[model samples]
Target chain A: MDLSTLTYIVVGATFLLYIGIAIWARAGSTGEFYVAGKGVHPVANGMATAADWMSAASFISMAGLIAFNGYGASVFLMGWTGGYVLLAMLLAPYLRKFGKFTVPEFIGERFYSKGARLVAVICLILASVTYVIGQMKGIGVAFSRFLETSYEQGLFIGMGIVFIYAVLGGMKGITYTQIAQYIVLIFAYTIPAVFISLNITGNPLPQLGLIGTMADGSGISMMDKLDMVVTDLGFKEYSTQLMGSKLNMFVYTVSLMIGTAGLPHVIIRFFTVPKVADARSSAAWALVFIAILYTTAPAVGSMARLNLMNTIQTGPVGEATANLEYAKAPQWFYNWEKTGLLKYEDKNGDGRIQYYNDKNPEMAAKAEAFGWKGNEMTKVDRDIMVLANPEIAGLPNWVIAIVVAGGLAAALSTAAGLLLAIASAVSHDVIKGMINPDISEKGELMASRLSMVGAIALAGYFGLHPPGFAAGTVAIAFGLAASSIFPVLMMGIFNKGMNRQGAIAGMIAGISVTMFYVFQEKGILFIPGTAEILQWEGYTKSWFMGISVNAFGAIGALVNFIVAIVVSKMTAPPPQHIQDLVEDIRVPKGAGAASAH
Target chain B: MDNNASKYWQANVRLVSILLVIWFVVSYGFGIILAEPLNAIKIGGVGLGFWFAQNGSIYVFLGLCFYYASQMNKLDKQFGVSED
Candidate 1:
């Protein structure tokens, strides 16, 4: 079959499977919509959680991030996975025992204040919306690459598919759909990786292939060979640190941890398990599922780096000196070239493409001696690295089709999860909890469906007009969650002395500070001239005492904690029953029959 | 007057402290502050510190959770607090 037909068949079939699951498992009641009736099996919940967690960020961008950044990007691997450990140990089981429909509901009830719940609703919306934009971009990239549509057109198509199932199925529909998505995505991600691994290192497992022998008989280390390639190209050694400061890395990692713990979509996954023990087990299982991707990413990165470098820069696998523009570039090159992600410039009057580091003019001199002007890969977008991998290695058409379907599965699954989270927070927490206290469960469910529609429209708008840097948008989302939601929930569950006033104040403070920092950096939103006064570019580079401003969420969280603690101390203590409520949550014995409130 | 309840709490705290230590060591310990010193060691052509940063800490975290869960289950039975 032709590439276009093959891709269309795979993508179309996957969408049908998702919509079919959404219809078959349509959420019947409020309970079913919110927490899948609190009866999801541990393994199934794990897979669903993994799908919810991985997002397009994990599937498409992670390997590209690692491939470009080398070892430093490991923070993403460690921080993201380490977050699950925190979730499993510190939050999930207790939150499950507290037995609420949403993270904010727990905060509001535990803190005994509507104000606190409202603050949580705000934070959840902000974090989720920003993160969804990244997913939308991923969908656009996948659609344009596979279907040959323009990016805007691709986003519209992506949004239309999400609306069908997400509006119809809700959380219950999403959970089962996510399970199937997890399977497709994992298969899509791994198959191409294995093929590349075999071709490059003669090892089928990309994880082991990462450290295996190079295709060349030279016996040099893979990292060493990689270091030599980029360095030869006038770039810093692959092992050398370039942009970010160490203090900044530490702060960034910590920020990610806090952000991961605070995300509404991930936290809500814990609510699906029947018992507190199951919740705990599910958290670990979620990590186990997530680890499959986390572990594979670096292997993919290393292998892609080696294969890319060997194919383009040097001899056919082993020789030191190879022609720069051999026209031998794989089909993946032409495919991605149409997307403008791959480009060529014949600098030294040589027809071959030279991809050396332009930063090092001295090395450019050596390459120029060989009639090469400079490096040719000017627009190699990172997003193309994963989706283009199979094509890069000349894999079969089905494998390429599967990657397209996989990318869609990842984006759609995460978008569905986020949309459900937004809808529930609106209906369950903001509306039912705040606006209409007398509203019945049935009415609230209706309100939820309405909210889902609204949220999808909003996401569609962003997808059409995506921000300049999609990844930067995701970082801000993380910062918002870190600063706002995580702190409020943590204090609510663990600290009995916290008052409603303090909880509300802290959340507002955290969210506001993080938003101010983000808005200040991106001046396009407001009148550009005043951006210097309101915005702080330095925050991204360094925060208080030289920490990355992304860590502002953690600091904002700290402010909330301190303010809440101090205010609670100055005021009257929490009532005796509330104190006892905290204790009850700690004990997991009667968790089986617990309320799914 | 329940010996088992006190015993359970004691065991729980002890196990939690131990696991937390391991967690902090592998993540904050090996990945950040001690990374340069630890990178001196190599495993399978990668630096030991880099391996820990990328994969080792996560494996340890998973192991830690299982250990904690099993021990907690044991403590629950011992303290007459097993889930019904």
Candidate 2:
């Protein structure tokens, strides 16, 4: 079938699937709204968590970051996947055993103070709201690409779909729809990767192909080739560290792991399963689901790099000489050209467009030797690599359509889960738990829907505005999550002595310091002179002592633990029975032992 | 409330400590500090460090989760805390 038709069919079918699930599994009460009634199977919950965890950033941008950054970006793969270890071992099962609907509830009960819970709700909202903006932006990109609508129109359609599914299904509907989405996204991600890998390295696996020999019979390794491309183009060697020291990498990785563990949407998935064992096992299952994409991503990056480089060096597959003219570029080039991800400019008046960095003295000499002026590919958006892979490699249009739908699936699935987390925290934790204790189950559910509507609208507004950098902004969201909420939750679970005062203090300190650093660098939120305020030499490489502000979670969590301990000693500990409750949560069978207070 | 519950808690803490040590080592240790030394060796087409950053740690993470879950299940049983 034609590309346009296929795009509609795939997107239409996925939309129908979500609406069907929403209608079939509409949430019934506050219980269903919060925890999917604690009845989701381990496998089902795992799929949902995977879908929730693998946001538009993961689906749309991670591979692109990896492809461009090469070995340096491996921090994302390790930090994100390794975070599940923290979740499974330190958090998930106990949180399930605690049997609470929200992270803030645990804080309220653990610290024996409403103040701590309120602080938690605030942190969760900040982290989630920033994170949701990335998803909305992704949705707009996908819709505009596939539905052939303007980005603003796409944002509206995406929001409408999310509003229907999220407000109606709550966790119940999202669980099943996410499972379907996981399948769509994984298939969409892998098929093109497999094809590209086979074409490039004579290997079907991208992971192996990453380090595999070059098909060109050149003595240089694949990494060496990548190094050549960027260095030739006024960039650093692909494998060589362009920025950040070892310590920063450590802090950054820890931050991502803790942030992943701290994220409310993912944490709430543990509450959906039936038992403590299921919660524990479900984290394993979630990792397995996540690994499908995580494992393949680097492979995708490596293979896509190889494909792109080869395309520039030679004319498509089986051709010898380089094709410099705009007319001779493949259909994929033209297709992606419409998205503004790929473009060329003829410099030096050479018929062939030289794409190497003009600033690189060595590569400049090579280009001069070849009678070329300078680099010609002006704007190559990295994110397009995964989304536009099929078209690039001469794959079918249906495959390209599948990718569009897949990107949307990735964005929507994560957005729904995040919006739901935001809503539940607002309604169940703040409104019901704090602002109005006597709020009815029905009223709380209504509040949840209203909050969902509000959150979706806010996300849409940001999508229209869009932060300056997509991947970097998404990293900030992770940094916020890592630095703020994860640490508070960890202290709540492990340290009986941590009090409300300490938790609140730690969260504020950790989140604020991290945000200050990032804002100082980005100058975002219309803050004037943010750049001059926090000036440090080697700031790009050093990024707050070479710790990606994303590592703020470990720093935040550590500070929370230390501050909580110190403050608890200075003040009084949580009530005695709260310690008993901590003991109760430690054991697995205690899952059913504690009733919702 | 009883000895069994205390015993289960101790055992759980011990298991968590061990698993967490491995988790930290894989993610922070080999993948970060020792990554250069590890990268001296190659896997597929990438360095060992890069491989861990990309694929190996994730597999180990999977193993760690299941290991923790199974160990916790046994602890639950030992303390007569099993829901089953």
Candidate 3:
């Protein structure tokens, strides 16, 4: 069968699996809806958390980002994974001990203020809604490419799938479904990587293949060869290129790490595990599962870039027969071209494609010498790099189809998790904790379902019009989480004196400053084109102290720490009972199951 | 609040601080701050620093978590606070 039909079959089967799991494990009560009855095994919760955390950005956009940015993308690799370390050590065990249904609920009760919970709820929604936009972007790109639907149509389909499983299943359904998704996404990610790695470096493991010798018998290493090839074509060396400033890279990594720890969806997964010990180990397990893809990604990225570059350049630069002829392009070229993601123009009427760094003035001068009008292979969308990898490596139809299913699984699972987080915060924290403290269990369940539907619809609307690309936009979500949520959560657990005034003030100050920096750079609430209104120049010139907006979260986090500390010192300490609550959550003894105050 | 409980919390805090320090050192230190110097020392044809950034630090993170879990288990038991 053709690729599209095969993709349709594979994707359809996965969707069916998700819906079936949703039906089997549908939430029947508030407990099931929120924390899955706190019955999840550590290993299972780990797998589900892995699926919940690795969104379309990781599966699709990250390798592309890595491929293009080179070593600097380590911020993502280390930042995203390193947070789990912090989570395992700092937050997970204590939060699990707290045994709450929602992150905001924990904050609300721990800080001894409904106002604090409301602040957390707002931060969670802002970050998560922004995050869903990135996933929606991924869904749109993936669906349009594989399913051959319009971007809008693809988003509608993605929304429909999420609606069915997430609204009905809640955390209970989403958990089981995500475990299956973890398997699908990890395999979909690794198989082609193994094949490509083997093809490139004679090593089956992409992690090893990255540093292994070239299969071309060039005698030089893969990294060395990449450095040589790309520099020959006027791009930076693959092994050591930084994003911009090293300071920006440093702050950026810190933001992502803290953000990863603070993400409400990820934290909630820890709540589902039965014990404090389980929370710790499940975090480890989540990292292990995630590391499988995270480690393979760089190899895929570097090797795919090598393949992509070689496909266009064909031979050494400055040679007459170097460029690939437009008419003689490979089938994968035509296939991706059909999606309008990869295209070429015969610049200078050479009937050949020149895909080089036209922005590099030195290469630009060289291209001018060669009578090239400009770089002709235009519109190589970074999101397509991983999705197109298997095909670019000439893997079989089944492999390509599996990648499609994997990308969707990654996107959909995380979207479901985020939507669940938003829905629970609305129903459990907002409605029950504040608005209707006496809400019936059945009423709460219904509210959860209704909010889940609303969340999906809202996410779908934002997905239809995203502010940034998949990965960069998702980084903003992390920044918000890092600056706002992470500091307060840490303070709540670690600092017993952290009162309601401190927690609330910290969240406001941290999130406001981070959002101020981001909005000033991107636009108000990322509406786009509004940055000019702020007289914003660009990152290179305007980034404060060489810190990009994504990197500004660390500064905001610092602000949060400082402000909360000052505010708490100025105000009264937390009550003795709240201090007692903190001391109780510190130990792993006599921890009951998930409970509401 | 009690001595034993306070000691357990203290031990947990120290462990987390130590592990977090290692985490920062591997990722930020070897990977970014001293990457250029570390790159001079090659590993399997790749720079040690680059490897740490892209690959090695992740392995370290995994080890840290598993180790923290095992050690925290020890602390819990020592403090007579294991969930069991």
Candidate 4:
């Protein structure tokens, strides 16, 4: 079958499977909608959590980021994965023992203040809405490429599919569908990787293939070869290049780790499992599952870089036939060009595609010596590395089709998870918990569904425009969560003396400082023309003490800890009942069965 | 809190501290802070630091999670607080 038809069939089949799961696991009550009736198996919940955590950013964008950024991108891998350790150890089990339906509920009950809960809800919404926008953008990109539709139309279709399962089945439906999605996405991601690995290095595992010798009669290892090839073209060495300063990388990693631990969508997944032990083991299981993809990512990235460089440079630089003829470019090159993500302009009227760091003065001198006016491949979107990998390696059409399905699965699964978190925070925390304490379960369920639709519409709108925000806003989301939600949640669990005033004060202070830094750097609320100051010319410089806005969360978190501690010391201690509640959450025993409501 | 519950909680905290220390050492210590010095040592075809940053630390994190779960469960059993 043709590539387009195959993509449609594979994507259509996955969508139908998700709809089927939604029907099978249709939520019957508010309990089911909110927490899947708290009966999910540890392994099943782990799979769902993996699906929830590995959004479009992880599946679609991360490898490409690594492919281009080289060693600097390791912050994403370590930061994202390490945060799960913090979650499993510090947060998930205690939250499960508390047996709450949402994160805000825990804050509300623990701080003994409706005000604290309301602040938490706002933080959760802000972090999650920004997060969902990225996922929506990922969905649109996947759809636009595979379905051959405009980005806006693709986003609408994605929203329609998510609306069906998420609105009907709630967490219950999303959980099972996510399990299916995890299977589809992992298989789709690994199969092409394996094929490409064998093609490149004769190693079946991409992980080993990354460090293995090339199969092309080159005695040198793949990493060494890649380093040589790119550097020969004036790019930095892949393995040894530092990403920003060591301190910045340290702070960025910390922000992402804490951010991952605090994302409400991930934290709430633990609530779906049957026991506190399940929550603990499920977090482990989730990381185990996520690690499968995370470990394979570096291999895919380095190998894809090697393939792209080889495709363009066909031979050693300075040689007459070093560049690939523009007229005879490979099928994968043409395929991506049709999407306008890969473009070639012959500035020197040359017929060959010159791919190099034209910005490098030394390389520019060499190009000038060769009578080349400039780099001819005008644009190569980094996102195409994974999507175009199979085609680059000439894999079967069916494999290419699976990749499209996998990308969609990744985007949709994460979008549904984030949307559910946003909806539940509004309906459960805001509406039922506050506005309508006397609201019926049926009414709460209706409110949840309505909120899901509204959240989807809002996310879709942002996805269309994608504000002048950098692609790395995934880190920004983590920074917000780490600064605002994580510190307060930790205090609620670990420090029983934490009072309402301190908790609220900490949240506001943390979120405000983090947002202020981010907005000041990116723009006010990321509006294009609203940036108070512009980025430094020639080089990206840190705003405060060599710390980029992306890494400001650690400082914000520290500020929160100090402010909360000082305020708590000055004010009255938490009530005895609140203190008792804290003690109750620490022990694993008598984690009462999740209430049906 | 009962003596047994207090003891169990203490054990949990101790175990978490140890594991988190390891977590910090591998990702932040070896991967970032000490990355330059560690890059002198090669593991397979990659630097030890890069390997930890991309691969080794993630594996350790997964192990830490399971290890913590098992240890905490044992502590729960010792305190006679294992869920029925």
Best by lDDT: 3
By TM-score, how accurate is candidate 2? 0.93
lDDT for residue A155 in candidate 1, whole number 0-100: 92
Model 1 lDDT tens row, A158-265: 888888877777778888999999999999999988888788777888777766667667787666677777666666666544226666666677778878988889
- After the best TM-score superposition of candidate 2, give how far the Cα of residue A35 lies from its true spot, in angstroms: 0.9
lDDT of 1 at A82: 80
Prediction 1 global C-alpha lDDT: 0.78
* Per-candidate TM-score against the hidden true structure: 0.94, 0.93, 0.97, 0.97
**Pick by lDDT: 1 or 2, better one:** 2
lDDT tens digits, residue span A1-597, model 4: 898999999999999999999899899889899999999999999999999999988888889989998899999899889999999999999999999799999999899889999999988998898888888888888888888988889999899989999999999999999999999999999999999999999999988887788898968878889999999988899997777788888988888889999999999999999899999999999998899999999999999999999999999897878889988998888888988999989887768888898999999999889878888888989889999999999899999999989988898999999999999999999999999999888888999999998998888888877777746577778888999899999999889899998999998898888887777767787887665464445434465778888888888888888889899999999999998888889998899877733
| Displacement of the residue A114 alpha carbon in candidate 4, Å | 0.8
lDDT to native, each model: 0.78, 0.79, 0.90, 0.89
Q: Model 3 TM-score?
A: 0.97
Q: Which residue pairs in candidate 3 have backbone atoms (N, alpha carbon, C) closer than 3 angstroms, thus clashing?
A: none
DockQ of candidate 3 (2 decimals): 0.88
lDDT of 2 by residue, A1-597 (tens): 788788999889988988888899999977787788888989889988999999888887889988887777878898889889889888998899889888888877887778878888888888888888888888887878777888888899889988887888788888888998999998999889888877766678876666777666774566666666656446666664623667767777777888888888899899998898999899999999999899899878766766777677664321224645566777777777778888877776655555666677976776676677667888889988888778768888888888888899999999988888888888888888888989877887899889888888888887888755544666777777787788777777777677767777788777777777676666645265666666666557335455655555566567656666676678767677988888788776646632445
For residues B1-84, write the lDDT of model 2, one tens digit per residue: 578878777788899899989987877777777878898897755678766777888889999989888888877777788989
DockQ of each: 0.54, 0.72, 0.88, 0.84
Candidate 2 lDDT for residue A250? 76
DockQ, prediction 1: 0.54
